[model samples]
Target: MEIVTGMKKITFGVFLLLLLSSFKLEASNYTFGVRIVGKGKPMILIPGLKGSADTYNDVVAHYKDHYTCYVITLAGFAGQPASAELNHPLKGQRDEIIRYIIEKRLHKPVLVGFSFGGTLAIWIASTRPDLIGALIELDGVPFDAGIEKNHVNMDSIRRDARFRNEKIIDAQADYWQHVDSVRHTKKFREQGFLDMKELVTDTTRINQILDWDDLSDYKASRLMVNEMNSLDLRDSVSKISSPILVLGSWKGWVNFKTKETVAARYQKQYSPADKVTIVFSENGKHFLMYDDFNWMIGEMDKFLKSI
Candidate 1:
């Protein structure tokens, strides 16, 4: 009888341990293709240019122990496919996010954007301020407003347009091919920033959903990029109502006569005021999040906690 009771006790303990482990796993996994571990206000992450949900893998690992994190991969850019046409540009992307929030009933979720994704977050906060509880801008500022300084040479833009009536698969294949080709370049090889050598999935599959002919799709994003290249947001920082956190990279991606010169110019161009707190990672590049992951994660945690 003594040996039987001991056996029963051991079995019960093992079962209890298994039950607890299952509970923990379930708590850590959440819907919306996002994983959350802790209990707090939820945070949504928007990725960078030519980026995907996979890009946030490191960032998510850093923050998972703290907040309920939602990492979103925007349509057309990453591997995510759209049910409808990719006819909408930035504004369309914003609207889709808004609709997601409403449908999911995500309460005052903190919105975080990185690089090009940063512009989209700003658009949402500017247009749908009520949906957001707080905004985190990762090295992204608004475009300078004005026709004179921000005017585009349409002829040059026309000449440079790569997506004119291009099919989605063909465009994506070409884009990735360019990416693969660039990876072998001396400059990129030296940097070690390229994605993996063997891509398990052909990302070109996403291009099938895009509707290049849809002006509604191309208009806003094109305009925004144009204005961004032409104008400096330094003068207009005061206009943004939401609390802004600006981050700048020390290095620039492309070849410049001098990187220091480019960094200094960029820093001076988008310096924020008292209402906005700016953080600079001296070792970072345009993709500051990836360049300075721990610093950014700490900064984000500190900011989110304070808010």
Candidate 2:
């Protein structure tokens, strides 16, 4: 998935205020936190990297009347506490989500994940296919990007991931401040803004996203992504038995691939699954929720009702 980052005032400041205030955080023992709202059928919303529980404010606002929503904010993002004890934070997140479901008696809750959260949801569903209800992902999958795809040696990948993660953790203080320094630049900064423009149309949401990235526990978040990106889950998706709806964004890759090609790529990656529906946004970038809310939510609503 493409990532947009950094800060700029942008347009409509109050809208940003409204979204931030929607979630009331209650930290948990599971290296994550929850902001519960509404009542009835359970729904768990997971945000992307650097995302807070409030990232699902729009979805929560719409669904709170009918569904009991569990908006999750994982550690290392949105100023949530990051755990140092967990060897695998992504798995730590996945396992705890399963435990949270069992402990809370949220039987068959719908799982909605964005970006990295979507990747985690895939991990969660694949691990315990019987746990969650239906699965919905917004521009996220068990995709292994960044590292070369041709490398067949899994051990080498694991070692590389570990080294990169360790380097970040060692400098946990300044990891994200620069990627640290690697991504922190004037042109890079402009590109980040450009990314924001491409990914989301709502300026307030853009501002909110930058704050999330700014306050994010860069090392902790990178550790999780580093580990996640090392494993290719294209085939592993077959293990998930639940029905899935994936809304993908393809506008960013227009320079490199056609819409048909990008859509086909998403289909090919998710082809291992038995019951999966993949849809792409016509003009949206990565943040489909903010960029193409109407079309995105329409597809989501249809899927939710179908199951």
Candidate 3:
């Protein structure tokens, strides 16, 4: 029965093909899991630190009708297993993302990053403007350090508060070891929830955030935070050729803080870019997407559709 044998071989081949496809989408060798949606130009959606794909659920629903959404959950975040390369997890993942873009042949794909993902998106576009079409950042700055530098100078901000007390290698590692060790305890979630409450206004969302944080690899998350603050994209912003739209929020800090003052910060950071627009939410917290959905959507739609 040659015909029957041939069918069996074809079936096995199809199964293997599907297996490989699943593995690829799993981002096994990379630093993120990609879930594709809709049918149009590629639009990558990156969430905040320790955030999962669910973070972009509403945003994806909004954009899917027009753009194909590639929802990426970074490695070691929200239950995704930590990648073997952990020392410089954030930068390492940037390279992986570039590889995915080129390999996937997603020419001039739009990048939408939220919070830390927004920063990562900036890094991606700055790294290769040739591969990106547009960048949409939600509450993600070009660089975030506690210092008030007259300009964007990474060298000057190198030893800020975070690193001032972080020179010792062994001690830092041991500290993170202890930090992650208590992940299963209620104290971990409670503490994380308390800090997140300041950023996320919604009580329900804060609870969800705590869950994601506990599932995320503590060392990896902290390493990413360290990497983000250490690097300055103010100079590299000139490298980006694609259009950028940055939507931020000001949680109304006391004393002489206007929307313009807040918006000026983003303007200063992205000053080197050729095509960029900055907008701020009148009354919203750090998670602009959720806190200021209508205004954010309007800004996003105008900026994106115009491009």
Q: Of the candidates numbered 1 and 2, which has the greater lDDT value?
A: 2
TM-score for each model: 0.58, 0.82, 0.85
Candidate 3 achieves a global lDDT of 0.80
Which digits, one per residue and each the tens of the lDDT, describe model 3 over residues 63-140? 898899999999889998877664567888899999999888997899999988988999998998899999999988
Off by over 4 Å in 1: 1-38, 144-240, 253-274
Off by over 4 Å in 3: 1-26, 146-177, 252-257
Error of 1 at 259 (Å): 8.5
RMSD of each: 10.8, 10.9, 3.7
Stretches of candidate 2 above 4 Å error? 1-27, 146-156, 171-191
Which consecutive 10 residues in model 3 have the weakest lDDT in total? 1-10
Residue pairs in steric clash, candidate 2? 178-181
Q: What is the clash count of model 3? A: 0
* lDDT (Cα) of model 1: 0.55
What TM-score does candidate 2 reach? 0.82
